[model samples]
Target: MQEFELINRYFKGRGISRRDVNLGIGDDCALVTVPQNSQLAVTTDTMVCGVHFFEDMSPRALGHRAIAVNLSDLAAMGAEPAWVSVALTLPHADVQWLEEFTAGMHEIAEYFNVQIIGGDTTQGPLTVTVCAKGTVPEGKAITRSGAKTGDWIYVTGPLGDAGLAVEARKQHLDIDPEWLKKLTHKLEYPTPRVAAGQVLRGYASAAIDISDGLLADLEHILEMSQVGATIQADKIPTTEAFRQSIEGEAKWPYILAYGDDYELLYTVPENHKAMLDNKLNQYGIDAVCIGQIRGGEGKIDVFDGEHKLDISAMGFEHFAEDEAC
Candidate 1:
């Protein structure tokens, strides 16, 4: 199919219509207007075929993930999603695959009320890049540098399920069929916490999405805030499904080191803790308290009961051998 024809066939006008989008797909450039008293929150994420996901994975899920990951970035910064642009590279124009992919993208885009403004398509091995834009009231966007020494650390939703799916697939571990189904659901259809991010606004001191495992992603906040932290190992909510699915210490590596959880890890000052507790439940999000920020210089300590656990920094790294959490 022709390049423009392919886009028109599968992607054009797929996202929800938005007033902020002065111009959308098929244009030389997308023209958008940021609302008064709001700042644009923009983020881009690229997913390669083999590196980011198995080459044989479904295009439908790929479409969702391509958009979801970037949305996760906006969520971390307390932004409400508004517009998205997609740059998709393909080996060839497989009509069926493209249809399913766009369907997946449309599902999330409509759910979030975001518009697909513009993008490009090209021939390549296979890669999907999405640039997501959102809005946050001026001076209200949560950032990594805003964390303070007295802030309490929290995470939205469970962790390690997506990571478990990766390990089960890569190592050929015999995970229970029912459990594998659950784990893979997390891996493939992660729900970006866009609403939670918006609600966090003035409540959170700092926030980050857990795309690269808890420790690795939390490090971004630590580095930026110039503070240390102490995590209670038992307090890391690994979900009841995870406990019922995996056995013994086997789940620890996935919970701590494996990436792709896409949950939000954030900090709230002690004074605002009550406000967060009161408001977060209204969003139907459970924020688990796992740690506290401290005055040290980026040191992270994890404790299991009375003993301090020894853990290495083993989160996902591009172009490096995989390591355990």
Candidate 2:
């Protein structure tokens, strides 16, 4: 059967929704409407084999990632997930692959309470693209540029675990069994700080999801918000497990430049810091104040209290063919 036909069969078999979806599968484009008093938040992310994941990567992981990255973007906007659409490209329609992939995607959708409302399937290179839709409370979408000088910078979780996980897999290090599983999970599956973003709606002056490394991503907020920042190299939260794995070695190289972390980096004003801290513990996530935004233009400083650290090696630029080769 054709890939779309198979998908059509799957969608028909499930029978999830009918109202609010005026145009679904078989149309040139799918259309849906949101009720009054809600604003739509949409984000799309694409992953290709070899580019995003290594060869022979598990379908379930790909499926989970396909949605997670997009959802992370929505979380940065403080959006509550409502519906998601997928665009999958595959060389062939393998039933086992589709089953596993959808299962993984469905797991996250259920967890976030978003339904797979519409999408398309086609034959091509093995790529997964997800466009997720979420809704924020009217008049309250978090942005990347609301930060002010003296506002406290915060990160919701540890950094660089995903990068380390990728390195571990590439090297096939004989890691301790316990640590191996955790790091592998980190690389393959990063939890989006959905709950944290939701709670930060009122307290956060600016917010961004850390798909990219912390410094690099925060630099986005700085650039957009027209400000500079000073980060204390010691203040970033590193998991005891992650720190132990590195044995007190230098961390900024990876933690500041690595992508795929999928945590939240945000700014909360000093006045709201204690309140936010109280809420952080109440919400059950570690919120680390890493730095303060300052008034200036496009400058980021890394320091150990009094001494400055050169940060020439920061941010992930896309690899060119020459670099890849």
Candidate 3:
């Protein structure tokens, strides 16, 4: 199929309609209307075969994950997702693959009320890049710089499951079959906490999504906020499945340093705890307080019960020496 034909067949006119979008697809550049009192939040993420996922992995899941990762950014900033543009690279145009891929992409877009605006398709090694756009009320968007000393840190859901899935996929871990299925789902179809983010506006002192691992991602908040944190080892939330699948001490790497969880890690002031709890309850989100912000500049102290723990490895590094092809 021709490029335009493929686009029209699979991607054009897909996703939830938004009155704010003046033009989408078809044209050289798509146009969108941001509300008068809101700021646009834009993010882009790219997924390459082998590096990001196995080359033989499902195209449908890849489609979902490509946009989901970008949406997680908007979620962290407390923005409502609206529009997206996708660029696709493939060695050959496979109609069946494209169909399933677009189906997965549009499923999440419809769920999140995001529209596919415009994009490009071309020949190359398979890769998918999506740029997502969202909006937040003026001056109300959560950011990494807003955390203050005494604020409590919280995560929207359990961590490590997705990372565990990656390790299992690599044959690095011997995980249970049932647990592997659950972990694989977590890795492939991460739920962007859009509602929690929207609810957290004006309530969370600082916010970030755990794309890189709790330790590394939290450091972004600490550095931006010019503060440190004290996190209790036991306070970090992980699923019972994760705890049961991996034995003692071995689980810490997945929970703390392994990446790809894509859950929200945020902070709330001591005074906002009550309201924050109410919001989380209203949203039916499982969240746990993991630590408290402290006075030091960008340092994180971790403790297990009363003994301080050593934390040297942070998480996945895309540009690390070992990561190079």
Stretch of 10 with least lDDT, candidate 3: 316-325
lDDT of 1 at 269: 93
lDDT of each: 0.85, 0.79, 0.87
Error (Å) of candidate 3 at residue 48 is 1.2
lDDT of 2: 0.79
| Local accuracy of candidate 3 as per-residue lDDT tens digits, 52-113 | 87776788898899999999999999999999999988888878888898999999999998
Clashing pairs in 3: none
Candidate with best lDDT: 3
Q: lDDT for model 1, on a 0 to 1 scale?
A: 0.85
lDDT of candidate 2 at residue 233, scale 0 to 100: 71
The order of the candidates by lDDT, greatest first, is 3, 1, 2
Write model 2 residue lDDT over 134-217, tens digit each, in one string: 888887889998999999999898887777677666666555767767776877777888888888989999999887777778
TM-score of 1: 0.95
Full-model lDDT, candidate 3: 0.87
